[model samples]
Target chain A: MATTDKRDPRVVRTHNDVPAVALRLLLDEGWEAVTPVRVATEAGYSRATIYTHWPERIDLLRDAFAQFSEMPHHEASGDAELDLRGELASFSRAMVEHRLDRALATLAERTQTNPEIAPIRNTFVADGERPMRHTLRALAEDPAAEAALLMLTGMVTHSVLMHGTPPSDEVLDAAVDIVMRGLAQRD
Target chain B: MATTDKRDPRVVRTHNDVPAVALRLLLDEGWEAVTPVRVATEAGYSRATIYTHWPERIDLLRDAFAQFSEMPHHEASGDAELDLRGELASFSRAMVEHRLDRALATLAERTQTNPEIAPIRNTFVADGERPMRHTLRALAEDPAAEAALLMLTGMVTHSVLMHGTPPSDEVLDAAVDIVMRGLAQRD
Candidate 1:
């Protein structure tokens, strides 16, 4: 989240401001409500300026998600597996506490017909992947690491959201233990 | 799926007929469009009859889901582990082939404020669990079997729906293998 931009303060302000409005509208209404024109009108920016910044409809989501997609991260402990577990657990807690799980379900529903959102999902996945991918790679080989990442993140996302509650301690332990063991010795 | 019902044939037809129309509307136009009145109109039943059958708005979804909740099941193999894997994989494929993954994402979204849907989710879970839970119990202890079911199903659900594609064989193997190993020997 470092910023060493030499850009003017006004330019920086608008860059962040427009997407913030777009994201707020997305959360308040739904993804379908977050048009660039609507965001510009709401954010007090010129429609021409908004279009210039976001030439495509999906670009608005891209910008909005780019600003919002920094998932939880933790320091790398000596034990990669333990660090990975802690990060995953932290992400789980964050998703529940922020109610991002609902947002995820909404986006997922949209993904069925709108192929445009695929890249946004990929970005979200990559953002999530960064929080664990390095540590996972530390524990297993190439495909095994990717496989472990899928199981760990997918379990956390589905359980916390679909169950509509925070994960219980025992369930969390079972999920992490399985993936850890799976990573420790892949066939 | 057995019915030894002695109810009058006309009575039985209305019972099955209404929910099938509701489910069709749900899949075609989304859940919010499947109101009892709308369904009654579309299904050629009286509004009063729809009310008697559904009682509440959520009842429409409950009835629709009841008819649709039977997940893919497999004949039991002597090896519970193998049978469980086959069942899980089959369910994964069914969700993709039928595009129930999107339906799941939609239902999951509804579960947020609609506490009434919780039972529907549980019923869906139990229906899914039956296909593998008995064999999972044969392999693991009480909570472990439940935990294994959660991981196995959750991983498959999240990956297939969120990724918006069928799971590759490698990814499916990795997910099932991890949970299988996790269940085989829990510390």
Candidate 2:
């Protein structure tokens, strides 16, 4: 069964279960409130089993965030603005729905002081930015494309963190329109 | 003479000197090494005077960061790439020359936990990002502009914090060239 389980359904389920339980703990309480013991007990797993998979809470979290940043869940619409808006909406909704914003913020703040976590955090940023880069590159020349990507990411991050609400879908649509139209080749 | 003495140019110099001394102490040693009494003594100011202005050591540090972020010390060139390169260079040099990266990182982490300092930190980010937004707007027609900005900022920040050195001037120039060319309007 172990050999047949190359795509081991059980292992996949457990791996998936770990992050979900951890994320819920993070969102329901706060980052500070989560402990490996708590997570393992909550997930109905033994402490040793959880520890065997992730040596520490930080390792588990690093993996959880990596999973969170993975691009596939955010399906791309062929339309650039639509795609971008949908992706951002996914981020915003996740923040509000899970109440994960505070935990996420805590993770970000820790990146500055904790050398081990900083690279993991940077990796998350790089991965999240990839689709935006690809979309922007196709839309305009380098300088313009680069600026648009930064602006979009920065604006989205700032809006969510500062306002605790994503821009209205209408506002985001307008922003995408302005950005895309602005980047369109001028005579 | 007491009233005039308080208003003396020397007093102005003395008031301004406190933060400078604190900054030097922070960089020369480390943030943990800094104390309000030490800063006051180093600046040759009375503890009462330092307290009158800044109620806490963190308040003093936050004010220093605020002053530093706001100073119109570096001018941006009209050309987008040149302007960005200039800004990045100045920031990198400042971070590198004083060996302040660790201290600043520590302070940034403290700000997250310290409610009083968090707003000050946010203000600094908002202010620093304002010029970048203007630059992005001007270059909006180019899709690459936005991504270029993000990458460039990421590169500079990463280079300094991770690599612990300012990138060579040649490298900075080349990065600017690549981004500018990448965003150049399609003929």
Candidate lDDT (C-alpha), each: 0.73, 0.61
lDDT of 1 by residue, B79-138 (tens): 766786687678777786655776677777777656778788777656766767777777
Q: After superposition, how far is residue A171 of candidate 2 from its true place, in Å?
A: 5.7
User: Any runs in candidate 2 off by more than 4 Å, and if so which?
Assistant: A1-14, A24-46, A67-74, A92-108, A140-147, A158-175, B1-14, B21-50, B70-73, B76-115, B129-187
Using Cα atoms with residue i matched to residue i, what is each candidate's TM-score against the true structure? Answer: 0.88, 0.62
DockQ metric for all predictions: 0.51, 0.11
- lDDT: worst 10-residue window of model 2 chain A: A155-164
- Candidate 2 lDDT over B1-187, as tens digits, reads 3555657676677667877777667656655555778888888888888888788887777656655564453486677766777776776676656443554454444443456756765676566556655665576553444444444554454444433344667656655554454355423
Best by DockQ: 1
TM-score, predicted candidate 1 vs. hidden true structure: 0.88
TM-score of chain B of 2: 0.74
